[model samples]
Target: MFINKAFNMKYLSIFSILVFTLFSSCNNPSKTVNPEEILIQRIDSLNKAGYDITDYHAHLKGGLTIEELLEHSRTSGIRYGVAVNCGVGFPVQNDSALSAYYRSMKDYPVYQGMQAEGREWSTLFSADSVALFDYVFTDAMTFFDKEGRRNRLWMKDEVFIDDPEDFMEYLVTQIETILSTEKIDIYVNSSFLPDTLQSKYNELWTNERMQRVVTALKNNNIAMEINSRYKIPSAKFIKLAKAAGVKFTLGTNNTDANLGYLEYGLEMIRECDLKPEDFWKCKK
Candidate 1:
């Protein structure tokens, strides 16, 4: 495990907490059982089978503190890669801020991740500073449309889809460009679509488009993120990626403190028949 020394000190405590919590739940008079029992069981099974269950896309926004995140890790049995958004308009715009952010999180028991925001992130921070984190990840959600308009896909108002077919081809091209040009470890929020094109996910993300993105990931040696928050990159996409020898990571991309138990990601693991070798681990 690529865990920090401080994390080792707290490992026993976290394990003890999980044991006691489970015991307490079973001791309830009604024995109704906790709803998370299934999730916890799945995590335990996966861990016992040699899988390092982890969440690679977590944030500190929405009043969530590091202590709270650590506590969640203990109970959920999932390690985390806590990231700070860095880009042109983000908080950590320059190397000075990036270094400061790393200092604050270096001692924590979690992997420090940089969520590179826009395409211009290449100019915002130096490669040396970006490499300070355990791993770096980005998405194709922010790109310039053919009209030269900046499109932040998540924001409905900022997304432009003049023609669905044309938009999808352009989106795939942008994704391929990012994978080939950027020095990133993971590609997150894979197969995401704007609000307008969301309903046509299956139609827009055709096999050809999926193959182009998957080929890029495999060629670049980048892991793909199975985003739980968005529940994207349908099972078909995952199976295809796996068939081509592309590894995967689980992510929440949480907006607040509600970091789910990686329900969707776990489902994909089973559906895609992914093995320990099919997952990516950041070696620090």
Candidate 2:
């Protein structure tokens, strides 16, 4: 009887080991979730639901050819708005150059955009030339601070922050002035801060400051860009802007060829309860 019991126990132990190995293989980490697949599905669902998703701040930089852009658009299911930087330092400086750029891209199915750089862009480009594009956008990153210093927020060397609070207030005023004065349809790189102040973005960008900027955008009929590169204009700010009836746009603001699928903006859509009607579409 004892011999028979030991033989049965050995078989039972082997059976248990086999079952565990099978379940372990099935639940292996290597068979993990496909985030790319999930992302594609999410985009597909949104597109099917009548969301005209488009990235209105893509650039043709870093060997990113127009043909490549078209192919990416086809595969990604997101449209593009090819913009040329228009200002003193940029390639398209004058009205002639701007017009030529537009003419070159006119036959394409994408929206031609003018990325107005610096405060002097209005002085450089003609109104007729500016009107040639599908839409125009600008950001307050290029502005003079209280010290009369041209503080380009993106440039670490140029940004000056003597007092964080005072600098933030200055930024808010600059945004207000840009919205009120600039002839722009959309504002890209919204709510951006310098590297030093970036970590304290939440603290520096106070309620009053955000409200001021949002009110300016609403009053001037400008759309706010939800930038994917920086993932900025926080959910709180977006919510406030939505409450104030401000429209939103998605932007990759790409510096390279790898133009993402606007993942951050899509996340914002679900988080901030944004709908199709909340987006700003360029009506040509």
Candidate 3:
């Protein structure tokens, strides 16, 4: 009888351990959750919290058709603004090409954006043709330096960086000019430095310099883009702009079909405490 009792107790202990293990496994949430699901949940939470969550700098390059963009938007839970490059060297340079491009995709649900390139874009496209877009945006990437050399920041050969300090000052002046003179709604690729000076972005973009650009944006009523592709205009710059009541737009500036999720912009929104009111929305 004593042996039988001891055996029964050992079996009971084993059964209890099995039951506890099964219960723990059933209640574990992390084991069943995925990263994509977590991202979607956070996006849904932000949407419910009054954020628009739009990517205003998508491009149709790399065979990225409207159908693919729509599918990506649906899966990611983000709205899109498809942009076309318009300038001297781009595909759509003149007013006729701009109008035809607009007519081709005007029926789509996504917002149409005009990415005005080069300093001569204001002269190339008429105001009436430009006004047809939902919004117009420009960057300081293509500008004539003080030496009268046309510097394209993206192209290594076209860029001329003699003195880093001088280059930063000239770039800041170019940005100020673009914001003040150009009739653009948003300034994409804000605070971009050439690859040479990219590492010194924080050191080069001083408080006074940042204030100068922020002041221009405020004075001209131009929204600054929180570019996810470049992850630019640092958190400090963003906070200063926000404090000065400058509006912002989220952009990807995608050159290919791989439209990355706007991780940097979303992080900035949380870090800088940006609300929906801080963002620029299209009236149309």
Clashes of each: 0, 0, 0
Can you list the residue pairs that collide in candidate 3? Answer: none
Q: Rank the candidates by TM-score, best first.
A: 3, 2, 1
Worst 10 residues of 1 by lDDT: 28-37
List runs of model 3 lying over 4 Å from the truth: 1-33
* Alpha carbon lDDT of each predicted model: 0.93, 0.93, 0.93
Q: Model 2, 111-230: lDDT tens per residue?
A: 999999999999999999999999999999999877789988999899888989888888888899999999999999999988888899888888899999999999999999999999
Residue pairs that clash (backbone atoms under 3 angstroms), model 2? none
TM per candidate: 0.89, 0.89, 0.93
| Model 3 agreement with the true structure over 1-284: per-residue lDDT tens digits | 99999999999999999999999888987888887777667777888889898999999999999999999889888899999999979999999999999999999989999999999999999999999999999999999988899999999999999899888888889899899999999999999888888988899999999999999999999999999999987999999999999999999999889887788898899899999999998887
Once fitted onto the true fold, the runs of candidate 1 whose alpha carbons sit more than 4 angstroms away are: 1-31
| C-alpha lDDT of candidate 3 relative to the true structure | 0.93
lDDT for 144 (candidate 2): 86
Model 3 TM-score, all chains together: 0.93
Please give the distance, in angstroms, between residue 110's alpha carbon in candidate 3 and its true position after superposition.
0.2
Task: State which candidate has the highest TM-score.
Answer: 3
Location of the lowest summed lDDT over 10 successive residues in candidate 3: 35-44
TM-score of candidate 1 to 2 decimals: 0.89
Model 1 global lDDT (CA atoms, 0 to 1) = 0.93
